[model samples]
Structures are given as C-alpha cells and as structure tokens.
Target chain A: MQRILNVFVKYRNSILYLFLLGFSLIFLKANSNFHQLKLEKISLFFSSSLYSFSNSINRYFRLEKENQRLLKENEVLKSIQIRSNTLFLYTEGCNNKTNFPFDVQRVNIIKNSFQSQYNYIIIDKGAASGIKREMGVISAKGIIGLVQAVTDNYASVISILNQDMKINVRFKNRTTFGSLIWKGKNPKKFSIEDVVSTSSIKKGDTIVTGGMSSYFPYGIPLGVVTNLENNIQNGYYKIDAELFENPAELYKAYVIENSDFKEINSLMQNIKQ
Target chain B: MNSQILKMMGSFVLLILAQVLLFNQINIFGSVNPMLYLLFLVMYPFDQNQTFYIFIGFLLGFFIDFISQTGGAHTIASLSVSYLRPIIMKYSYGLTSERPKSILTDPRKTNNFVFLLIFISVHHLIYFSIAYFSADAFLLIIKNSLLTMIFSLILILLISSLYRVK
Candidate 1:
C-alpha cells in the first residue's frame, strides 16, 4: 500500500494529464458522431451574444459589397419571376395545382467558417423563425449548405466546404451526376467523385445541385469544373471545380424549408425498407 | 500571487472572446486563420503549478473547440503543447534560471523566437492533424499546419510586442 501510494504520487501529473486527455478524446468522438446536444445548445447561446454582435459591427464595413450582391441577386430573381410568369406548370401525373414546397427565408450568417474539416455556419434565424434540420441553404450565386442543427434564434449550417458534406450535383444540361465533397484543402474548390468515366465531362462544365434528395430545388448552381483526372483503378473521373459563391465573401443566405421534406423522406425510407 | 490568478482568469476569458470574435474572422489567403488564442499557453509563467497549467490548458483549448465547433482537436493540441512546454523551455532557454520574463520583451534573445515558432508549429500540426483526422489528408494536414503556423506565429509575436515597451 505504501509503495503504491508513492508510485501514484510520483506520476500524479502524468495521471491527471492522461485523464483529461481521455475526457477530451471522448468529447471529440461524441462531437464527431453528431451526438452533441447540450454542447450545441451552449454553442447557440454563445452565437447570439458573441458571434452576432461582432457580425453586426462587421456588417457596416461590408455595406458596399453586400449591396452589390443584393443587386445581383435582385436581377437574377427578377428574371426568374418574369420567366415563371410567362410560363405555366402543367404536369400529366399530378392533378393538384403546383404549390411550391420550398420556402425561402432570408437570413444573415452570424459566423461563417471554412478553416476546419467539418465547418458550420451560424445563421440568425432558428426554430422561432421556422428553421429546422435538413433544410437546404443557398446564396445568391449557388448552394451554400444544409441546416444540420437548430436552436431557438440560431441554426448551425453544415457548409458545402465541410469534408463530411457530400452534395449531389450534376453537370448543367446533362444527366451525368456526381457527389461533391471538399478535401479540406481549399475553400474555393470542391472535388466531385464517383462520376463514371464514360460521362463526357470537360473543364468549365457547370455543376448544379441535383434535386434527387429534395434538399435543394432542381438546378441551383454549385460550381464550374476546373480539372478532371481519370481514376483508373475505380474507373471513375476525379473532378475538381471552383465554387461560384466563395464562402468567405458570403454574408447573407436564404434558408430554404421544404414543406414536403418529411413526407418525401418518409416515402423514401419506406421504399428502402 | 493572488492578483496573478485573477489576471489569468480574466485574460483567459478575454483571449477566447478575442479569438472567436476577432481572430477567427480573419481568413488570410482564404485558408490561414491565425489561432491567436494560443497566446495564453505560450506566455504562461513557468513557475506556476504544472498540473494546474496543464488542466487549464485543456479547458482553454476546449473552450475554443466549443466556440468554433471543431470537436476536441483544440483541446488535445492545447493540452499536449502545455504538457510539453517545460521540456520545450528547457531546450529553448538552456535551463537558464532567468527565463525571459516575456518572449518578446527580451527581444535580443534569439531563443525566444525559436521557442515561439516551435510552440506554434507543434500546436498547429497537432491541431490540423486532429481536425483533419484522416490518413487520406496527410499532405493537407502538413500544408495547412505550416501555413497556419506561420500566420499564427506572426500574429502572436506582433501582439506580444505591444507589451515589450518596458
């Protein structure tokens, strides 16, 4: 008993260090598995006081750029409005009149981060504003991210820049599709994988969000293909693209809620089962 | 000594607030966001209780991790670096009783600069490695750590020099 006590006393520092190290590693694992409930709420609380305040101060400095972006978005929206007004939705399968399932809510990003592997952005709107998980977010230029977690008054989005987020995207004007993922290498670039080699792809091809998952509506621009390499072993093309809306420059985004998301998700799950 | 603990606690909160609010926003070259929160551990007094320092180091990094939502990468990196600081200081100052009061206040000592660089690099490497957390991104970890370390080293050194007026 005396010898054991002396051993523990001598190595007490190392013992404590290891204990804390284990505690942190456990936290790391919990967070990685997306099981962070209490910590996430605490983060949301901090976001309101800490991030939002700084964001407001920073907003004044970027007024000129923000105005320009809004103007560009306005132009895009106006054109879309004109086209929609001129056209009509007529489908043979469904007799019900088209009520767009997607709801677009404009929200300000309190904090945008792309430095880490799994980056998340905090938006000002949350449960009070009808923001919920699995809702897709997009900027004026392209798809931004998906809402992964929500708290009252704030929602954390898993940005497209995150390594864990693989967005389903297809080449413009073509059915060829690939899953877009970030390599944690560069913020401006994304890699498209699992593209069959037979798909005719070229540099500068436009990549847009695929509506298969019902996350983003069909045809939201994502990026333009910049490079392509044939993965001979997998017989697929490893493609890279430069994003349209650079996340770092982004200040505002629209949180889109799909009214039929749960319905569609349940149907898909039922089919799988 | 009592006042010192109070100052440490005060600066602990202040530094983390500055980190999440101020430093985290600056994305130099689009990828290298300097982790200025590391200043606390780097400047911690060598005479303080080693065990306490190590534990607080974990909390210091854990707070950053919580704010930034990077899991425990910051916690692990910060904890390890604080644990290794004594050994690092041993080599950095060559067991001199007169460890420079401040890394930059005693600017003539080239060892101070080396110490700062090593500290930042090790922390950044461990940070990027854990944050990336995949053998697939080994090269990315190195590139990110190097770029971020350079910027972090510069930012901390620049901020510390403000106190070098004495």
Candidate 2:
C-alpha cells in the first residue's frame, strides 16, 4: 500500500492528464450517439429564448421589406397552387402524380449562408414545431436542405451548398438524373454526376428533386443546367447546375414533415434484409 | 482567490452570453464565425490553479457546445487549451515570482498576447473541425477552420487590447 501510494503521488499529473483526456475522448464518442437529455433540453430552451429575441429584433428592423417580399411571394405561390390544383384535377386517375406526402411549416430564416462549401442555415422552427431530424426544408423558389439539428423553437439546416451534401437531382424535362455536389468554389453552382452518356442533356434545362430521397418530395425545383461534360474513363455525364434559390437570402422556408416517414423508414430498414 | 474566482465566473457568463447572443449570429462573410466565447479561456489568469482553470474552461466550452448542439467538440478543445495554457505562459510569458497576475499586465505583453491568440485560434479551429468531421470533405474543414481562425484572432486581439486589465 505504501509503495502504491508513492507511485501514484509521483505520477499524479500524468495520471490526471491521461484520465481527463480519456474522459474527454469518451464524452465525444458518446455524444456522437446520444445527447444528454437535461443538457439538450436546457440548451433548446436557451437557444429558443435567444432566437425569439433576435427574431423580434429582425422583424422590427425589416418589417416593411419583409412584408413586401412576402406579399409578392404569396401572390406567386397562390397562382402556382392554383395551377398545380388544376393539373392534379386533370391527372386525377393517372396515379403518376402523387401529391407530396408531408406537412410543410412556414419558417423564418434567422441566419443563413451560401458562399461557403460547408454552409448551414438557422431557421425559426424546431422540434417544438413538429420538426425532427431528416425532414425536408424548402422555399418557394427551390429545395433548401434537410434538418440537421433541432432545438425547441429553432433548428440548424445543413444547406445543399455544403460539400458533404449530395442529393438526387434530375432534369425536369429530359428525365436525366444524377447526384448533385457542391464544388465549394461557387455558391450558385453545383455539379451533378452519374448521368449516363445516353442522356439527352442540354443547358437551360430545369433540375428538380428526383424523389429518390425519403425526406424531400418529388418535383421540387433544384436548379438549371449550366454546363455538361463527359467522363472519358467512365463515359458518364457530369452536369453543372445553378441553383435557383440563393441560400444566403432565404427568408421564409418550409419544414416538411412526412406523415408516413416512420412507416416508410421502417419498411426501408426491412428491405435491407 | 475569492476575487479571482468571481472574475472567472464573470468572464464565463459574459463569454457565453456574447457567444450565444452576438457572435453566433455574426457570420460576416458566410465563412467566418468569431467564437468570442473562447476569449474566456484565452484570458484566464495564467497563474490560476491549473485544475480549477481546466474545470472552468471545460464548463465554458460545454455550455457553448450544448447551445450549438455540436456534441462535445468545444469542451474537448477548450480542455486541451486550458491544459496546455500553463506551459505556454511559462515559456512565452515567464512566470515571475511576483504574484502571477502582475506579470500578465506588463506593457511588453505582445509575446504573451500572441501566444494566447494562437492558442485561442487553435481551439476554435479544432472545435470546428471536430464538429464537422467528414473524411470526404477535408477541404471544407480546412477552409472553414482557416476562416474561423482568421476571425477569431482578429476578434481576440481587439478584445485583449481593449480590456483594461489593471
């Protein structure tokens, strides 16, 4: 016992450093899987209170401009909704047009970024507002991204501009589909790969979500074709698209909650078997 | 010791409040976020109890991390900085026998300030890199870290200069 005490006393600093470092590493590892409930809840409350104050300040500052923009966008949205409803009526029995199976909650973009290759946006909606991880986010102009993290009344969105983000995008007219990637140099541009050489690709074509993702609905606008190239080795087409919505200026967005998301996810999980 | 503890707590709250309320919202260039909360860790009294300082640093970082919801990246980063801070102060600032706080106030404090700034920048860089760890997007991590460090250094320098540390 005396020898052990002496050894511990001699190496106390090293022992303490190792122990602290080990705890930190373990904390990080555990955090990747599950968050502490009390901490998360407290954080959510704190973030929400701050968000509310900031949001109010923003509204006070930009009331007139935001009102005008919203009015214009609302007019456009009403017209589009009418047109879509008419189209749905005509294709009532066709079964090809499945109305989006999600609930979309309107939200304000409190903070946003697009210039960076790994940009993220903060919206004024969160778990308290029926939002959760993996929900689709979009605006009147186009698809924005998916929910990355959620507090009580606020959430962080991983913008499609992020280099880590890849989504199934397809040309609306030519039916050419590919995986879209942000090349990190330009906020307005993204590269789409995996289109076969046989695809009838062209510039000035509109791109939209391919519905391959369970989060976003089919036919949500993505971008327009800007450039196309052929991979000599693989003989596949790589298309560059200019996104319609400027992610940096996203003021109002929609958080889509698919009612059947759980059911679909469970089914897909089983399909892996 | 009582005054030092009070100052530590005061800095902790001030940093966290600034981080959550102001700096977190100020992404000036879409690529830069000045993590001013790191200032607390950077400015902790060099001669403060090592274990106590480390605990304060971890708590400060944990509070920020909890709000940002990026796991424990900030906590780990701040802990590392606090652990290394004493060594840095000793090497760069030279711990004088004079009650350690006075050594920090000398006008020839540029070296110490630079050391502190570098340490703070490294903390922010590591925190951001770990928060957005992606093997495929290593370039993004590098780009963001550099941008954040640039902003963090500028902000920390400005604050250190303005702080009337008597």
Best by TM-score: 1
> Which docking band does candidate 2 fall into?
incorrect
Task: Name the regions of candidate 1 deviating beyond 4 angstroms.
Answer: A34-273, B95-108
Leading candidate by lDDT? 1
Weakest 10 consecutive residues, lDDT, candidate 1 chain A? Answer: A85-94
- Going through the candidates in order, the fraction of native interface contacts each one reproduces equals 0.61, 0.27
* B95-138 per-residue lDDT for model 2 (tens digits): 67333463236555667666766686668667766676545667
lDDT of 1 by residue, B11-42 (tens): 89999999988888888888778998889888
User: Number of clashes in every candidate structure?
Assistant: 0, 0
Point to the candidate with the largest DockQ: 1
